[model samples]
Target: MVTRREWLLASGAVAAALALPARSAFAQPARTVKVAIGQKTIAPNLVNLLIGEGLGYNAAEGFKAQFMTVGGVSNAQVAIDRGDSDISTGVPSFALPILAKGEWGKAIHFYQYTYPYKWDVAVKPESTLTSYEELKGKNIGVPDFAETAFPVTKNVLRSLGLDPDRDVKWTAVGTGVAAGVALQRGAVDALAYYDTGFGQIEGAGIPFKMLPLPKNVPMVGGQFLMALRERIAKDRDLMVGYGRSVAKASVFLAASPRAGARAFLKMYPEAAPRGSSEEDAIKSVLLATARRIKLYDPPYAGAKIGSINPEEFRIEAQMNDMKISSFDAFLTNELIDEINSFDREEIKRQALAYA
Candidate 1:
């Protein structure tokens, strides 16, 4: 029979053992974060995120990525607000209204796909319209009046000394094929859309010339990685990992967009554009990736790949006619320092090695 002293000694030993730092047999597994993209259809920009997942970059950073596709930017924001997703991607234009209404939290821009604007006004190859001035009194087809493309195009026209509301007639035509068709049928004299739209038109055997926006205008549009303020506060490390993975993927894209496209196709073959063969899909992604790559060559005012410039946000707000009490209220660079911490040369090496 055990004595009281022996029982006391046993209890002490058990307590000491419990205090030891031993791995638990039933420890919880690492988490997988769900991320949503703004559009239901995957575009070339999303290919980088896919490449990062396929390459295990996110895993290396200590979490797994589960991508979720939503109907549009508003849906993506709703996913986060409803706690269905932890992160989402979209333009600040989409996020601004949400933030204004207190419907969501801040936007953290991780990808600077273009400066000033991503979309442009384009005319037929043989059309005599040579400049923004020529666009006056002409009908310009845009993706949607409510979308960023419309206001951005209007701003560009304003910078060109034309009143977008009065001098130019704006028509709502859908993107890609629809806008291309409008241009082809003379429904609109020019189409204001992204480079991808131009690619779509040219690939369909139509020739066009892009009307350049003035370089002196402030940077007005780009994409962003966003999360609710609560989520960002609680899961900063996860966001950092996400930023790092995407930064590495951007390097991979810059090195070889074709490889990025291949990885994307391997993961999501269904993302192939409508009516496109696998080869055509790859070509389309390559073309889109090439254009995005140019935006990073100088790296957005020499900042790191994922860094956001406060002044740029001010300009964007002005262009959108958004009134903000503070830029910090809507944007943050908290994760950028960590994302840019990796050795760029090493990132390039790994990117080149991605099969």
Candidate 2:
């Protein structure tokens, strides 16, 4: 016969054993985070996306991205509109016009990074055509007929004193591998390929060079990460957490360039060129990616999720030159407020190690 004290102690021990297993089970459950990819290729972005997945960052934040490359802003917008995808990447310039046409039921703009990420006029390195001026009368391959790529290409051409309408020819090819095929076959004199796509082509032993833009020319508009606004608001904490995560990631990329590159490659093995040291190539890529990252500033520099500035007044002015009056309508950073409230220092610290 046990004393009352011993009886109580035995009961407590039983409860503790039961609770231990429950805690372990809860910790082991895999969370799902559905994200949509705007394109189908593995390039600069795959590393970030992969990091979110491989490192369980997305799961920790309660997300599992269902990545599909619905190539072009118009197509990506339509996917979000139809409820087929939850998030997408699109030119800030084009998103406003699409939303202006009607109220979208889901998907909202949460954040943006003004990385003048490279999407250039690529040609075989052996070719003698050295200047943008030579693009006159050339057949330029575009990923989509209606998307940011063509507009950016045209903007660059005009910046070089070439009339996009009459000076150069445009062709619409599907993105990634398909666009590379067009360039390889000489079906197009120049192709507008993003840095990642360019890397893939280069990795395939195809000798191509991105036509360098004048240092001041903007090839890509400021880009934003868009999701269903209502959904984002409902899960405001998660959305803000993501913003904090990206801010952390951005700062990490800037401060620890080598570590960040390694992290990126680990997340997306396909991001690196075959037979090339992923470590070294990422360093080269980061050197270039860093400049573009600067364009977004604040949220990036301060590692604060929701910070934005009107300094893009210059970029807006550039859009105005394109006769884009609707520019201001879609550039909303209101949602970033939720992200700013969280502690992002650690995430950024971890992410920079990937650089």
Candidate 3:
């Protein structure tokens, strides 16, 4: 297994790329908002986030954005709980368990950045595992045990009437080349991962036959931007403005995913693999992120982004065998209107006119 220390030593580019200078706007912000995410590499689903930074969406909203890279979601939550970071990124299902503890002190999942979970369970082309039932007693691979993929896989197994803990074994295969290599060498039977994980593997020439999400599963509300309740109450402008900036970036990226991929490439050139061509790098990112881009567009009838869908989380709670006292405790739609109050047509025009 690739250790975290080894991974960090090899990821100097990722660290260097994150040392971004603050974008300039007509008015400077009062303070820097530290936003944490549980990733080292630039995943496809984060195309909108990169675009948001690249295009000065945060600066336009009157704040400076600092992207912080941490070990995992659990760590990211700790960062927020300990007052180290203001906001963290993660999906709804995987977050349910951590949020249920109430130990995080009223952390609110205020922003819905991506939705209709573009997650998958898959097997190698030669594997005979075609259904969830077949997954019983089999080992599964995930990027990491701390990620949403593992819990989602466990709950998916539960939906199939199998004991997730006893009936299945899970292994952390790592991500990018490490994950693909694990699957290639038969380190695990099947992979329970998101679109970006699968796309990168396929991009490396390892194909998979995706197992369909069980009928009982509700794969909506992919990922969220979470912040502490006190922070939201005290820093309402920063919270809402950041969401608005992300909404604008999401709109622009969703309007033209290819353009978004191109923009990401230009913004973070180090994102590409050392020897990969620009065209190949674009294809790799697009392959991983294209399906997710569709969900970036506002799903609500009002054409607004970042609106929390509690019902989806409720179903997610049921599927994951997690208990929630109340959805409103951790979810909110109070800022949806302000978040979506942007001129989306202009974003589309900019997307279309990308040079």
- TM-score, one value per model: 0.81, 0.69, 0.87
Pick out the ten consecutive residues of candidate 1 with the lowest summed lDDT.
16-25
Q: What digit string (tens of lDDT, one per residue) describes model 2 on residues 1-355? A: 1122332333322222211010111223254433444454445643443344444455566654445554445555555555555565655455543344443235566576445545678887677777788889889998776555776677677766788899888998766567778888898888885565555555455667767676777534556666677667677666665655565556555556566666666645555555667565675456434444454454345544334443443453464353344434444577666555545567556755542
Report the lDDT of model 2 for residue 335. Answer: 62
Best by TM-score: 3
Per-residue C-alpha lDDT of model 3 across residues 1-355, encoded as one tens digit per residue: 2232333353443333343433443354667788877665556667776567667677777777777767566555555655667887866654565556543356788888877666788888899888988998898998987677887677667767899889989899998767877877899998888877777777878876888667856554368888888888998888998998888888887777778888787767777767999898888888877677778755557645787778777877777656778776777788888787888899889888877
Better of 1 and 2 by TM-score: 1
After TM-score superposition, the amount by which residue 47's alpha carbon in candidate 3 deviates from its true location, in angstroms, is: 1.7
> What ordering of candidates by lDDT runs from best to worst?
3, 1, 2
Off by over 4 Å in 1: 1-30, 97-116, 273-280, 297-302, 320-322
TM-score of 2: 0.69
Instruction: Order the candidate numbers by TM-score, best to worst.
Output: 3, 1, 2
Deviation (Å) of 61 in candidate 1: 2.3
